[model samples]
Target: MDEVEVVVAHSERATLRVGDVFLKVDGDRARAGVEARAMALAPVPTPEVLWHRPPVLAIAALPGRALAQLGRPSTASPAAWAAAGAAIRTLHDAPLPPWPGRSADDLAAALDVECAWLVADGVLPRDLVARNRRIAEAALRPWTPVFVHGDLQPSHVFVEGERVTGVIDWSEAARGDALFDLALLTLGHREHLGDVLAGYGTGPDLDRDVIRGWWVLRSLLTVRWLAEHGFDPAAPGCEIDVLRARL
Candidate 1:
């Protein structure tokens, strides 16, 4: 009897700290559309630290499967992928404050916060983030700024036929480097990269250096997170490969 609480994680696989709460938590499962899901979490209001605790009741599992569970790649068509990109762009350039937009100031600020975290953990260099800041700023220098999905991947996309059913998951949402989302497709569906970006009106001429740099950032930060929990992400060769290609 292993412990579990959620049955159906739903279209949007959000993090939840459900069940009986301690003053250290924010009620049950910090989410909507879920009930009786035991999500072990840390102090709400701010995720300082966390621990997993089983709940007395389990939220009824939803009637669906995660793309990861299917053991197959996404069925989202080129058109659907492009459509998601368009929608995510809107989220990026949102006029509301408390977020980043497609602007030099926005890019620098976002990079500063993210890079500082990586540097503090000794996973990357200060100059690395600085270089990215410059690239993102320049990439948009000639074009109208459009915010892009901070994180984009097959798993974050759900489709039914040529239509995109859902584009969930916003934890990494940000407002810079729209092309970075396309880069995700390159890694996930390299063969379709041309088609995917083409639908975005750019036609497959992605900036190799900048996209590769962002990939490196993902690898570095992800590997560091894994290492903190006593797991090594199969050496750093994958990261080195991307970096070398850019040189």
Candidate 2:
């Protein structure tokens, strides 16, 4: 009998791996729909969608290990990180997905709500949250939206040697700020950012300050969510570390 491996399970969704196939079960069917559409539209490599029914999507596993994992040192070489950056450029340059991503106002509202919760729960000091929130304001400015991998974490990228084999998890893919993806990709692994940017090719929009702003905003917004979902955003070299770095 094949062993059923639970890749991850949270209140909203769960993923399981069995041999070479992976299954994703989402509570919201619209997210799955967006994922399927985005995967079809993406120019870069993504997992092969084997089948999909309401609430459940099955995909064939990619050929390589993740580029990196949260809170752990990345074993992938700088070239692999650069390859991942190149893949992101390809995706961002592709035609925009039909759906819209979170707007600046939406992000502001989320930041407010998340900060309130964090302060009220005493998870972080008000001063820390306030300072980070102030720094996060820079990223709220407008820009031309591009195709963004809404949650482009290192673990979502699969790399073989120095090449990126595929990117996974398209549920959050949409038309949004490109810098947000870049920021998320390099969140904790700041050292590899040079490689990432080297392959990304610099532009006026790739502002380091704004990218750092997004880092603060992203870390602030996700800490409570991570805590609720049994993840420790405060772990060394993780989201909380990203937040504290602003000081």
Backbone steric clashes in candidate 2, count: 0
The digit string of per-residue lDDT tens for model 2 on 60-151 reads 99998999998899999999999888888888888888788889999999989999998999988999999999999999999799999999
Off by over 4 Å in 2: none
TM-score of 1: 0.48
What lDDT would candidate 1 get against the real structure?
A: 0.43
Q: Which stretches in model 1 have alpha-carbon errors above 4 Å? A: 1-98, 101-145, 203-209, 229-232, 235-247
For candidate 1, lDDT tens digit of each residue in 1-247?
Answer: 4343442233333244244221121233332212211111101011112333332222222222222211245555676666544444344345422344345455446555656776786665667545644543433333333444445665655544444444443334444556666665454344455555555554333576555555545544454445555444444334323333333
lDDT of the candidates, in the order given: 0.43, 0.91
Which structure among the candidates has the greatest lDDT? 2
- State the displacement of the C-alpha of residue 233, model 1, in Å, after optimal TM-score superposition: 3.3
Worst 10 residues of 2 by lDDT: 90-99
